[model samples]
Target: MLQKILRIPWIARRTNHNILQELGMKESQLLKNIKQLKLKYFGHVVRHNNLERLCLEGAVEGRRGRGRPRRRWTQDISDWLGFSVREASILSQDRDGFRSAVWEATSYSYKDPP
Candidate 1:
């Protein structure tokens, strides 16, 4: 299921409905599990504001929001899973800020791992 999420492009919270459907998850359950996974592994909560922003920014509209939006794992999640903590740590002093920085760096096509 995680792999499936990773494979999709331009994922956002709004479009995550389909991804959750594809994974056989209810909206509430999906959000619960995502939060659980994030906290368990990253030791931090996935902010609701961030989730909303991710949905808005990452969504791929089929026809200017008329059709279902395409979903992909948020760049933050993608980079977090792909990049090492040490690399993220060196990027910013604040934990959340570092994560954001790493995500932005990777999202903008920076190839360096750190």
Candidate 2:
């Protein structure tokens, strides 16, 4: 539906396809909520005993895969912010700035697990 609206050629074999933003529409509000939560969780001021913090920051061991590895949330967040993990951590501390950045980033249509 979006492709037809955007007039993107079907055979172009393109990627990074953000049709909603192109049409001056906002990405889903849920995505904004997720982004806000991720940023806040990663930048918590104190230890909150939150499982998500550990899960997001922890590295799993003994991973074996035949093909491509699983796409990680951290990796996606980094990609969305155009930042290294360390940089993202630093920037996530600023709630207002990070919110704006999230709004800008949700416009990117990069296919997942890139």
Candidate 3:
């Protein structure tokens, strides 16, 4: 998005970090913002927030729709952590572990925004 915003074509050979650096935007700042938002949202006790978190954690049971299952939120995070969603769910219990996992996931999948 940053590259496209700055008119940097996707075909360019520059790395994601390099493009952001040229645009005077620190990738770490974006990472920090994402972390802050995640922590704030999960820490809050609103009904909707709880529901959304539960959905992401796959705590709600329901019937399937069709063909292959859609990619899950926990799967994405677990892919970033190079592990399984079950383990990711377990780690989410610990505030610090969740943060670390997010950081790790971002560092790995930062270039490919979901």
Candidate 4:
């Protein structure tokens, strides 16, 4: 069910409604599950304001005259990570290699606590 939603490029509120209709589950229930999963895997970072803005911007777009843009479920990291893993595997030799590359690209390093 989650996989189905992740496959869509831009899942709107209406798309969720149709999905819920087909699955015989309430939208609220699905949302609750997503929230729970996010909390369990992502911790409080999922609730940060920056993440919220990124999610809203990535997931939705407003029409020229529409009231507001709708959030696309695919914008969420959980949804995108599935695809990212596959792409990462194809582009790199190993996870450690990818991590090193990322550190080099971003010029970021971790220091041990004193």
Per-residue CA lDDT of model 2 for 41-85, tens digit only, reads 555631344676667667769967788987876787787678887
TM-score attained by model 2 = 0.50
Q: What is the lDDT of candidate 4?
A: 0.45
Candidate 2: segments with Cα more than 4 A from true spot: 1-49, 107-114
lDDT of 1 by residue, 5-87 (tens): 46764444446666667778666555545644552334232323456445434546565655675553444454544555434
Candidate 3: lDDT of 111?
Answer: 53
Better of 3 and 4 by TM-score: 3
How many clashes show up per model?
Answer: 4, 0, 0, 1
The per-residue C-alpha lDDT of model 3 at residue 45 equals: 22
- For TM-score, the strongest prediction is 2
**Each prediction's Cα lDDT score?**
0.47, 0.64, 0.61, 0.45
**Of the pair 2 and 3, which is ahead by TM-score?**
2
Order by TM-score, highest first: 2, 3, 4, 1
Query: Which pairs of residues collide in candidate 1?
Result: 11-71, 11-72, 12-55, 13-55
Q: Give the clash count for model 4.
A: 1
Pairs of colliding residues, candidate 2 = none
How close is every model to the real structure, measured as TM-score? Answer: 0.23, 0.50, 0.42, 0.27
